[model samples]
Target: MAPSRWDRLPGGRLLGGLLALGLLAGCGHDAVRRAPPRSASTRAWPTVAPADPASANAVLMRALGLVGTPYRYGGNTPEGGFDCSGLVNYVYRDMLDLRLPRSSRDLAAMQGPRIPEDRLATADLVFFGSAGAVSHVGIYVGEGRFVHAPSTGGTVRLDRLDGPYWRDHYSGAKRVLH
Candidate 1:
């Protein structure tokens, strides 16, 4: 039998290992390390739990209240701040006690009814990325707006889905509440 694909390359195993290490190293440097502290007004919004845990509206409300929270790599709490996925994870956990995958890519693959952009409702998770990879997520809040912890030096903020940046990077959306 002809050698398998792996045997066709010179030092294939070693090359693959180096590529993996390079990718992992690149990931750590993507997020900004430090940002200005949260402003006092950022603390004004109250994170009130909604009366109904399963309601999408309730989840949206909770998510909106988190606007202005700082962004931190791998952070999942308001105190330490939250990354995009962290913000989504925290809100769902708080509102419905539903534990979601920790990464944006995993959340995109989660088993929920897929929602087309036109049908997206409040609390639906909107995804964004390039090269067919899901790298960012946000919670839909209506009026074509979504809330998220954007990036280093950026805090949770509401952004329009129609905005050039979001519109261009739009991959798809998923409704997690249902």
Candidate 2:
């Protein structure tokens, strides 16, 4: 049979097919492993809708602006750098005048509507941990991504929620911006 339209392209059918496959392969995986897996008996907590979209947007903007700030364990200001919860606290406080708990564990325990992953909204706090204990936290900026001060020597940066380490340590999320 004569060459088809695909063959008429610059790279031809084989190269085009390879490119398409490469793009599809970059889309990532199906089963993301969330640590401290939820049991069937786990409570189906209520999701909180963002009552103030403008405030949420402002919080997101502030968090994004702090992307390159260095990590400091007890830091809470742009000039002083920040830790995970410190980053969350600073962004919320600076943008919305909202005061949140100063540590990741305390922030996790603070009263707020629990948010299912699918229902996560901008400015929601995503938690991570293992063995049923909350450890790290980040401000969700939508699209399965968050901005956080990841570690010592690491500057605040954006990370994928479904990225290997984050996904495996993913504990839960809560909405503090209602």
Candidate 3:
């Protein structure tokens, strides 16, 4: 007669060994982490430049100065408020005479250079999202910094491209240089 079932462990030897293998595989599933770029210059670059200056980046710098401003969905003026793309259009229009689309969707469709974070230039449009959609945009001033209107109850301010929140959501960046 066959040995009584209770005489053996609950799991068959083969099953137990497979379970151990699975556990080991689980421990090795961690994804690789990518690091941000570092600058060779000791002096950190400024986030934005003056509205008008001798530097070619003056326009981009001026755009960054609008960060921290509240997100107004539809507001379009400095005193009132601004939406994501609206603020973007306004800045380029005012600073560089460049007219941009009024909505994030439309702006995302524009053709531009897909620049890496390390090569980001002042005035370039930094996009955010998984599909490289222009869900959110800001002006890259320099030194891994950007200027944008954060949200309601806020004003324009500067932010780091590598910030916890921004880094996670960053999709891509673009530059429309003539």
Best by TM-score: 2
Candidate numbers, best lDDT first, in rank order:
2, 1, 3
- Sorted by TM-score (best first), the order is 2, 1, 3
lDDT of each: 0.82, 0.86, 0.68
Error of 3 at 97 (Å): 1.6
Cα distance off (Å), candidate 3, residue 63: 2.1
Clashing pairs in 1: none
Q: Model 1, residue 44: what's the lDDT?
A: 29
| Top-scoring candidate (lDDT) | 2
* Candidate 3 regions with alpha-carbon error over 4 angstroms: 1-56, 130-133
lDDT of 3 by residue, 4-33 (tens): 444377756667677778877765653223
Instruction: Kindly list the per-residue Cα lDDT of model 1 for residues 33-103, writing each as its tens digit.
Output: 45457643233222323234458777888898999899998899989999999999999999888899999
TM-score of each: 0.69, 0.72, 0.63
